[model samples]
Target: MLNQIPLEHILLLSAVLFSLGILAVITKRHAVVVLMGIELIFNAANLNLVAFSRHDPQLMQGQLFSLFVIIIAAAEAAVALAIVLRVYQHFNTANLNQIVTSED
Candidate 1:
């Protein structure tokens, strides 16, 4: 029943998700929020890849590549979060506006 929706609709939704991710990444000041935005963007990309894979029965590699992307993203998030925590510890603030300081 759900398959009635056109491929255009799925693409539109993915575009919206990607836009929201970009907005969040640009507008948010917290590192965690930025990371969340990045994850959202990654998810949007994964959705597109999966949709394409499903559309093309002969090409199943997209889904496999998306799976790899997810794994890599998870590792990236972990490392980024650790760095954020260390920055917060040293600066006593998580706000991006307040985190940047002299390079001395």
Candidate 2:
């Protein structure tokens, strides 16, 4: 079923998602929302990797790389969430702008 659809369309969708992720990361001030934007960007890359790998069945390089990316992203999210929790405990706010003003 996927073979019928052109690769260009898949790539175009990934590109659009990547653009929106960038916008969210840039415009949003909340820490968790920014983290979600980062996840979106990672997912966009994962989509491209799977799309490209679909043509080559012998070597699943793209799929393997995408799996590694997913693992790393999970670990990153866990550590970042821990840090955000600590920051919130100290500053009493999760907003990025407020985090910058805290002296100690």
Candidate 3:
């Protein structure tokens, strides 16, 4: 039943998600929120990759690529969160703007 859906629909959904992620990353000032936005962007790509993979019965390339992307995103998130944590400890704030202005 899933294969009956047109690729356009999936692509459209991915586009919207990707756009929202861009907006969040651009507007948010909090470290964690910006990280969430980055994750959203990753998820949007993953969705498109898996969706395209589903279109082919024998081709698993897209799925494999998405898995690699997922692993990379996980590692990026962990490292970013750790950096954010250290920033918070040193600056006593999670707000990006505040952290920037307070730096002497």
User: Whose TM-score is higher: candidate 1's or candidate 3's?
Assistant: 3
Q: TM-score for model 2?
A: 0.92
Per residue, candidate 1 scores C-alpha lDDT tens digits across 25-87 of 999999999999999999999989988888788888989999999999999999999999999
How much is the lDDT of residue 28 in candidate 1? 98
Best by lDDT: 3
Return the TM-score for each candidate structure.
0.90, 0.92, 0.92
How accurate locally, in lDDT, is each candidate? 0.90, 0.93, 0.94
Candidate 2 residue-wise lDDT, 20-97, digit = tens:
899999999999999999999999999999999988989899999999999999999999999989988989999999
lDDT of candidate 1 at residue 99, scale 0 to 100:
76
Q: Compute the lDDT of residue 86 as modeled in candidate 1.
A: 93
Compared with the true structure, model 3 gives a TM-score of 0.92
1-104 per-residue lDDT for model 3 (tens digits): 44477889989999998999999999999999999999999999999999989979699999999999999999999999999999999999999999999945
Q: Any runs in candidate 2 off by more than 4 Å, and if so which?
A: 1-3
